[model samples]
Target: MKDQQDIVDNPPPGGSTGDPFTISNSLNAAQTVTVWIAKGTRWSDRDQVKAIKVVYADGTARVHGNQTGTSHSFKFDSDERVTSMGIWTGDRVDRIKWETNQNRTFDHGGWGGTEHSEELGNGILLGFSGSADSHELISLGASFREDSD
Candidate 1:
């Protein structure tokens, strides 16, 4: 487990634009995560991430960015917890991948851009913070807390 002092907010990746948003789950764990991926009108353009929604164990939910693409949802098992995440970004978020403690993996979006991976070694995902526009997600970052056990 990581030290409590080591848990801190990660800065958003990519060329972030638009208003900043923060969605936190400090007291509970996440139950589900949904991501939206959008493709450009032109055939040569690559796909980009549009939005993300997370539902917590308490039944409360929060979402950011725009709903302008295909949506993919991943539900966690009772004992499953997200252990790490990877994001690819350019001018916008291009791809996202999440891995659970159970070794389950969930992925979304297209492959094009710089990749940023977060390995949360026993740390709890506390929430997300980032910037987004009406058309797509501009940037994303994860927040974590030290595992108490």
Candidate 2:
């Protein structure tokens, strides 16, 4: 759905009442970032599919798909990356996968019918159904885990 007005005004459980779903972070390097959304039973009943949009450090924006439960990736090339991410949905996302370059990866396999939060690595923190503005913080809905090398 192209209309963001309705989603902004009456957001779902974890969404902001008037503000859009926004998460931002500052990164140390230019990296390939990937985000994934998994389809759930709630997706089938709605006419609008949930979407994830990403705003790079350079102010350019990229928009990614309906509730198809797939992975989407983009590149950020700024010294101090200011990456903003948002998810728009009428229900819960089954799973979310986030990876940065090859340095780190955060995976939230699925949601088990509630909100939760988890911390990954020294800088990555995630919150279920919420907002975050740094690598040390994140707010959204998903089961959490971290991987690094």
Candidate 3:
């Protein structure tokens, strides 16, 4: 399932209708520094997983994980620079953090600093990344969170 993201203080992105799910919407609509869940379909119905493809109007997506459950949070950010962020949770390992490609490319973990994440429920994780460049602010990694319900 997909819909326009307009919640809380977070408004629509690009001011271009904000209807980003349309195939006609330019892929460029997804270049920003925010994170919003794209909405998932019911599992038994054979729902195709919909992932966040563009940047957000608020801050970005953050994921949290633990034995208790996995959790995800999306909000607005004013001053955070990141290049890549991700959350990895599994039976053996569970971890999350954000980093700057420039920092990692140069062996500087401090470059992008660490992205903060928290677990919401099960193995479902949430996350997001930012960059100095406004257009390239969000860089996230995850094949896609597994259904933790």
Candidate 4:
């Protein structure tokens, strides 16, 4: 019999556009996440999240969104896993922060929107899903596997 997985999804906030995308790792946990932030003169059209890439424990990886900014990487220890995430968004994603079980944290991007955070107690981050345009990431969300215990 196939293993049953309990997946929890957090939908993106309103005012998001462009092609829909989902990047996931059904079998392996996430090991690293890289985010690209574009620093532009204008806050409305630029200075936002450009793209994201997640590398799984299995050495497999996936990248989404646009590629037009400086890249920042968040690497996790072998025994560590993501516990929660915080996002700031408006018409586009403005900032992102990730906290791990080890209490390590990584924050990036400009602060220019409403803040949304989620604490996934004991849950393992599997992937991310949302919408993005050719210029930046319009919206962002997350998917995780709930702890069975």
User: How large is the C-alpha RMSD of every model relative to the true structure?
Assistant: 3.2, 15.4, 17.3, 2.4
lDDT of 2 by residue, 1-149 (tens): 32222121212244233223433323322134445444343444322223445554455443333424455554543322222223333334333444444444444434333332223332222222333221111224321123331
Considering summed lDDT, which 10 consecutive residues are worst modelled in model 1? 1-10
Distance from true location, Cα of 123 in model 4, Å: 3.7
Q: What is the C-alpha lDDT profile of model 3 across 74-122, one tens digit per residue?
A: 3223332335444332111123344432343111111122333432222
| Candidate 1 ranges beyond 4 A from true positions | 1-7, 40-44, 121-123
Per-residue alpha-carbon lDDT of candidate 1 for residues 34-147, written as tens digits (9 for 90 to 100): 888888432238888888888988888999988777899988787776777888888788888888888988888888879998656355566677898777888888766545
Worst 10 residues of 3 by lDDT: 6-15
Q: Find the 10 residues in a row with the least total lDDT in model 2.
A: 2-11
- How far is 9's C-alpha from truth in model 2 (Å)? 22
The sequence of per-residue lDDT tens digits that candidate 4 reaches over residues 8-110 is 6778752457788888877456778899998632365546788889998788999988877789998778777677788788878888888878998888888
Which residue pairs show collisions in model 1? none
Predictions in order: lDDT:
0.77, 0.34, 0.24, 0.76
Is candidate 2 or 3 superior in lDDT?
Answer: 2
Instruction: For residue 125, give model 3's deviation from the true position in Å.
Output: 16
TM-score of every model versus the real structure: 0.85, 0.27, 0.21, 0.86
CA displacement after TM-score superposition, residue 57 of candidate 1 (Å): 1.4
